[model samples]
Target: MTLLPVDEALERILDGVKALPGEMVPIEEADGRVLAAPLSAMRTQPPFDASAMDGYAVRAADVETPRAVRLRVIGESAAGNRFHGAVGASEAVRIFTGAPVPEGADTILIQENADLLDDGSIEATSTVASGRHIRRAGLDFVEGDVVLEQGRRLGPAGVGLAAAAGHAMLSVTERPLVAIIATGDELVRPGEACGPDQIVASNGFAIGALAKSEGAQILDLGIVGDDSAEITAAVQRAAAAGAHVLVTLGGASVGARDLVRQALLDAGMSLDFWKIAMRPGKPLMFGRLEHRNSRNPDSTSRPDTTGTMRVLGLPGNPVSSLVCAHLFLRPLVARLGQRSHTPDLRAAVLASALRENDDRRDYIRASVASGPEGLIATPFSLQDSSMLTTLAAANALIVREPGAPAAEPGSRCRVLMLA
Candidate 1:
């Protein structure tokens, strides 16, 4: 089969994808969740004209003359408390920040600009203008005004805005549940003893973390030996658990022990694509499976019954699996969470000269640094798929188009920054 282009493969994988259903959650729990609908203000901010500073409230005309004006202090107003009586001529009311502006008062004379007398009166020392140091009603937001739009991720500021808008609860998209299965007879869990041919299983942990960072719930099925029956059972368990996306690590290539593909086919998976024309992750596979019984075994509370479960079969190589997750799985999770799915690519100058590329697209792990000319991306000398140290040290991925020509130092290039 011809290897699909990276762009085309991603397009196929994300076809017909839409955000999941939304659920109502308290504003405190809405942080980091995507808004499913527009959030409107329930009550006007400042409901009434209020004071913006600790001062005395008086008519502007009463304190406008060049000469100092004296006024009797009749009452006091503080936040959540208001003076009901109007301020008559030559009269003032002491007011604190956030206090409602009393009736007949048009300006605030800051306490520093006023001198208090022994007879319970204040002499204005400076000319004051009308409406100064007063927050008008609905100054921040009016009732029914849309404060947050649909599909926006709720950060700290967003949550605060919603709270200010009188929203105790917000509607947010449901978190995507991702099930992971690791396959390989030569694999064992971390901290376990291994033989000469055996290695510790790390892909499931890394992949689960990657999915979780994207706001997806993870269901790790642990390691399954390279057997068709065992692989089939794991796939069934994923379906039974109501996983939206199932990610399989290893056993995807066409090796003798590679039974993931055949097992998925036997378990009624519709293959979308098998391989892609990309470095580090060439044997990636995507498919969909229909679950006969749409019930969730993990939770007593039932979610919406979903007919099809998306499946991603990744290579056994550690770096390859992580790179593929960054390029593909993260976007899928974002889409399910109702967030934007576009890759964030930034332009940078190559720190060193690079060789010409082959037909496959390259995602070279590199160290990106800010330079006088902007960002400078320098690729590591060694890019072996099995090297985890290089992947760990990389802060960005330098993107090179297929069959591109060689470039000299300081050449312009595009990079995907890793968070």
Candidate 2:
């Protein structure tokens, strides 16, 4: 099989994925969830013009004429109260912070800036500025403003913003369920092991962790051996559980014992494509199983969501499986959650010499460090695809496009951050 180029493979996989299911989760549960619809302000912030300080509200012109304004203090207003009567030309009303400004007041003079003289009148010590310490209604936000756009991931600040806009609830995308199945005859569970051919089932754990990091709920199907029936049973189990994506390892390759590719097809799955051009994951296959739906008016028609189960066949090698999950599974999960699935590629300066890349693009494992200079990256000396130890030490991957020229130290490079 001809190898698929990295860019082409990425485009194919990404283009195939669309936004997944959506539901309304309460604000407490909405953190980190993607918004399904845009949220607008129900009411303007600071619903009324208010005093911003604990002081007297008066017109700026009144300060200049009075050594002592002995007007009657008609009434007092706090945050929840409004003065029923407006202040007369020679009258003043006591006010507190957050209180609505009276009809005739345009300025606020802080209590510390004024004094009460012997005659129970305010002495004019400080000159007042126009429009001083007054919070105008709708100053922070206006009604009908789209405060939060659809597809936005809600954080603490986002939740507070929505609440400030008077929204009691929000609609958000439902978390996708990614079912992980690690397949290898040599693989055993973490606790039990004896034979030399047996290896602990690490791929599923890794893939499930990856899925979780991408906001997908994980269902670990454990290890399936080389037997085709076992693989088939696992696939059915994943599908029956309503997994949005199914990831299987080991049997995806073209080895004589490789049974995943055939098992999924034998189980009535419609194949999309297999064998991308990416290194360490060239044997990857993607497809979906058929499910009938009688609820719709068109009984024979398969709804878009029915064909939504994304089956990813990853290489058996541990490092290969993890890389495939990072490059493909995580993004697939993000797309399902309507998140920005694009990898975060940061700018960096090449710390060491880099040779010309081969026909296949390279995702060189590297360690990242921060300093006064900027992000510094160091690629591991070994570039073997099968080594998981090297990948463990890496927090970044230096992307070297195919046919790229040799890069010297201090050259500008793009590094995909793994952390």
TM-score result, candidate 2: 0.83
**TM of each candidate vs. truth:** 0.94, 0.83
Q: What is the C-alpha lDDT of each candidate?
A: 0.92, 0.79
lDDT tens readout by residue for model 2, 321-407: 888788888888888899977788999988898999777667888987885789888889987977888999999999888788999
- How does model 1 fare in lDDT? 0.92
Measured by lDDT, the strongest candidate is 1
- Which portions of model 2 miss their true places by more than 4 Å? 64-74, 90-94, 116-121, 185-200, 292-305, 369-376, 384-392, 405-407
Model 1 weakest lDDT span, ten residues long? 292-301
Tens-place lDDT per residue, model 1, 160-241, is: 9999999998999988889999999999999999999999999999999999888888988999998999999999989887
Residue 6 in model 2: lDDT: 67
lDDT score, residue 376, model 2?
81
TM-score of 1: 0.94
